[model samples]
Target: MKFMMTFHWVPDTEQRAEAIERFLRTGGVPPQGVQLLGRWTSADLGSGFDLLETDDAAKLTEFAYQWSDLMELEIMPVLEDAELAAVFGRVAKK
Candidate 1:
């Protein structure tokens, strides 16, 4: 499945900076089973989003846990447009 993960930096500027440095130093690796498809950050740098694909939900949780101390995260399941259209087609035919 594909997932969208949003990361919102903590309100403290210093802490957020430190966490970002640490993540960069560590190469910001995602948890096992989770593959990063893309990433984007807000212009102001307060928040970011990652597009990831994974079959194991636990891997997503573990990835979130790794950053839980530095930022708030929102994980959402997502489907591509063609996938949504396929679902709609099935329902329409039924």
Candidate 2:
């Protein structure tokens, strides 16, 4: 399954700096079970989005926990456009 992980950093300079430093040191890689598709950050560096694919939701949770202290995280399951269209097609056929 694919998931969208959105994050908003805490409104604190020190925390943001620390998170950034850590990211630089660690390369901001996702956990073992999660495959990162793409990552985007807001122009102001306030919030960001990540597209990831994983069969194990627990890996996402673990990844969130790692950064939960410095930022708020929202993990949401997502489907590709074609996948959603297929669902709609089935409904229309019914």
Candidate 3:
């Protein structure tokens, strides 16, 4: 199954950037086939996210935990469309 990864912090851009950079610096790579859609630090800094794509739930969760270990990510939620008639298409799954 595919998962949507999101993180909410207490609101700090400089720290957020630093953390993300630090993560990459430490060679933190997500699961295979995961695609980074985009990332944003809220104007209020209440939260932010690096939009990503990953079909491997296990690997994705593993990587996500690493981030939480390094940085205190507030919230992480996964979602999916239950409708069989989704307009776009089905999320390719194994």
Candidate 4:
């Protein structure tokens, strides 16, 4: 399954500095079982998005916990356009 994670951080300078330091130290690596497909950051560096794929939901929770202290994260399961189309196709045939 694929997950789209959006993260937002506060305007506190101290918190932002700590988050940056942690990211620099860890490279924002995901845990085992979760593969990071891509990531994008806002121009103001206050928010970002991450696309990840994983089979185990627990790993997703763990991955989120790793950064939970620094930012608020919203994780949602997502599907590709073709995948959604195939689901609709099957439903239409039924």
**Could you say which candidate leads in TM-score?**
4
Per-residue accuracy of model 3 over 35-55 as CA lDDT, tens digit each: 666566677655566666666
Give lDDT for model 3.
0.61
Candidate 1 lDDT over 49-92, as tens digits, reads 99999999999999988888889999999999999999999897
Candidate 1 residues lying further than 4 Å off, grouped into runs, are none
Model 2, residue pairs in steric clash = none
- Residues forming the 10-long window of minimal summed lDDT in candidate 3: 69-78
Q: Which should have the higher TM-score, number 1 or number 4?
A: 4
Model 2 bad stretches (over 4 Å)? none
Cα shift from native, residue 24, model 4 (Å): 0.4
Looking at model 1, report the run of 10 residues with the lowest lDDT sum.
23-32
RMSD of each: 1.5, 1.2, 6.8, 1.4
For candidate 4, list the clashing residue pairs, or say none.
Answer: none
**Cα deviation of 73, candidate 1, in Å:** 0.5
Q: What TM-score does candidate 2 reach?
A: 0.94
Model 2 vs truth, CA RMSD: 1.2
TM-score of 4: 0.95
TM-score of each: 0.91, 0.94, 0.52, 0.95
